[model samples]
Target: MASHNGVNRLFGGTGGVVDGHVHLWDTAAMRISWFRDDLGLPPRVGPGDLARAVATSPVPVRAAVAVQAADTEGESRWLLRQSAAHVPLPGPVVLQYDARPTEPDAWAGMAQAVIDDGATAPGVAGVRLAVPGGAADLSDVAGLDALCEGLAATGRVLETLVRPEQLAAVAALAARHPTLDVVVCHLGLGTGEPDASWRDALAAVAARRRAHAKLSGLFTTSRDDAGRVAAAARAAVDLLGPERLLFGSDWPMSARVAPYAEIVGRTAAALPPLDDGAAAAVWSGTAERLYGAATRTSPAPRG
Candidate 1:
């Protein structure tokens, strides 16, 4: 058994560490249509595969919350099963539930599915809804609200990955679901062209206390600009505070850009000075709060 205590021991006893975002896919399962054999990415990444990967992490990953890589319910179910089995993830596994922005009924159905299958599941954390590239649409506000209301009822975090220009729309959705914790992935897509609006939009969303930020994938977006990544980390800490910030690997996708360990090392190096408790919050505690993983404890990993 890979105990939670095992990971704590790995990081020199920094206590429990949680990976806020992890993506696991099985190409053979036909879940990842974007995957091409020509791309030369791994054909599959299951729970055991993750154990190997995280075993190499600079810090022991006591628990990892996985998000869906394929846009399918099968993928979500597969992750939940993995979590139920305690397969390398002490999870609040975030499942991918796709609902068209214009379709509120569709959102309602998807949200209900989460409540039905995942709401009370110990391994399930909630859902991640992907916002396609281009402008975001809230024209279906009622539908979006239905999806959020369902999520709030289940106590799951609503995670979204949106471009900079689409952030205001995200903030608008957050406003509609004031009680829901909406986590903005990749620092509001801050990795691209230098845009002042990214910072402004981030500030706007940060003003919403229920909004949270994940410090991952920024290096890939910033083209590995260490200085820029560092500045953004500091700025996010300034605006959102350490309690609202969480760490994620954005793995496999990030693997194409840099080693997983480097991503972890760099993110830790980039953060602003924080007290021990505050640093723990960014590394693991905040994620626990967002998804209700605090009381779930497991044994340590083996040597």
Candidate 2:
């Protein structure tokens, strides 16, 4: 059982922490290509599990933004339903939909349709697309310009799951659409060992005022190097500042490597020291502002 006392002490006892990124899925309900039976994770992971994990963790997660795990509209709808069911594990649970189109020409229409559909559901804060190619490849993607325009016009975020090599493209994309809120997941897929190229590319992304990064998924690259992870985090803070960075646990997927508590604790430890204001921004404030989560409040903890 987790208590909010730690959060209270950390943030002057007024607000709770927000997990900027998390994933929940049911292997039986949908097809998650990367999730396997041998991965040591249960077939199903839901908000209840997140609640329990948060309870045990040193940081009390008041709200969460559920990112898309499976590339399907059904999974997005399922996440919204789950979020609606679990009002406040201390706060609100919102979600991002996968709006990637199978055909490049269909992107604009697909994005428009998602925005139209999401208007009725407040939980749909943004959309995510996996960018596997380089900067030139992204620019060549048909209807990408319109997709970014539409998302920017609608004030919906555009979260990209990009590879380390493609980070410069993401930065350019953000520059092209200044109004669109762009978030880079998993610290640009950086590892403990510093790469000058990765740092330079990340710095470019940070230069964009509307661009942000998630301090999550360090284990994926530097599983055994906590010091390396901390160093990377410090560099990110120096590059993006606390206001532009958000804390994400990347749970369930990260559960494949470490427990929820360790994930959150390690991320916390890796960060550069900050005053209360900066710490709150990284932990929750920035997420609340970026995702419009401030209005969503919880009466009490439930697990």
Candidate 3:
């Protein structure tokens, strides 16, 4: 974690930050079904927009992980291209592909394809899937087993956007595939009060050595309640510890509630008091370890 003028450099930033969950999309060029005009996000958002948003933060965002906004191979390719073009704005982009093949053989093929494709795309770090339902639903998800095996084989991460109840299932999934690195996005999307169920589910996730949670998207659920956000952050730290937690802005979408800097400030303020080592782990170290060396070198430019 080297520093320049007190600010840490990209990737290994002890004092600086690593935003593990930022989104980039261009509605005109990409088919993001959720990016409606009424959503309040700009029609097109790129690395430059994110760069400007975090430019004034108290702790500069040295690197970021761009998660998928659309569920298309084309979107994944587009993100790879964007990551290449943007240099280090987003060090790596998470990809999303079809993971719904019901047949075991078909599922295996799809999983193999993801690994094969990812082999060529140096800018890609992992894959994100929306697991909308709870543990039962996860059990019924087609091809998930194959996908987990493939990701583990390649050392790529499996990041899930799951609800509070689904967190226990995610923990089970991680426990099932011990070698696979699992990241639970948005602190299991819990809000209001950190109820017993939510805390238990998070504890289940923490029980898995390779699983982690992101302290992000609090504004989405907590809305303007900064106290709620702080409570959620504290609960995550209490349950998972800073070394197993990561910070993410969930930006552009978060812009609906507040500017990027404001969201960053609020979230930062909400975090529990920590020693520098623990703070660095939550801010950047955990993310770097989970995402691996996706940004160790500049990606090859795509034509």
- TM-score of model 1 (CA atoms): 0.84
Question: Scored by Cα lDDT, where does model 1 land?
Answer: 0.71
What TM-score against the true fold does each predicted structure earn?
0.84, 0.84, 0.86
Tell me the whole-model lDDT of each prediction, alpha carbons only: 0.71, 0.70, 0.74
TM-score of 2: 0.84
List where candidate 3 sits over 4 angstroms from the true fold.
Answer: 1-13, 100-115, 118-120, 133-136, 190-192, 220-224, 294-303
Measured with C-alpha atoms, the lDDT of residue 219 in candidate 2 is 72
> Which segments of candidate 1 are over 4 A away from where they belong?
1-13, 87-90, 100-108, 118-122, 137-142, 221-224, 294-303
Give lDDT for model 2. Answer: 0.70
What are the per-residue Cα lDDT tens digits for candidate 3 across 103-135?
444332322343345454466677776766545
The stretch of ten residues in a row with the least summed lDDT in candidate 1 is: 294-303
User: Candidate 3's C-alpha lDDT?
Assistant: 0.74
| TM-score pick, better of 1 and 3 | 3
Lowest lDDT 10-mer window, candidate 2?
Answer: 294-303
Best model per TM-score: 3
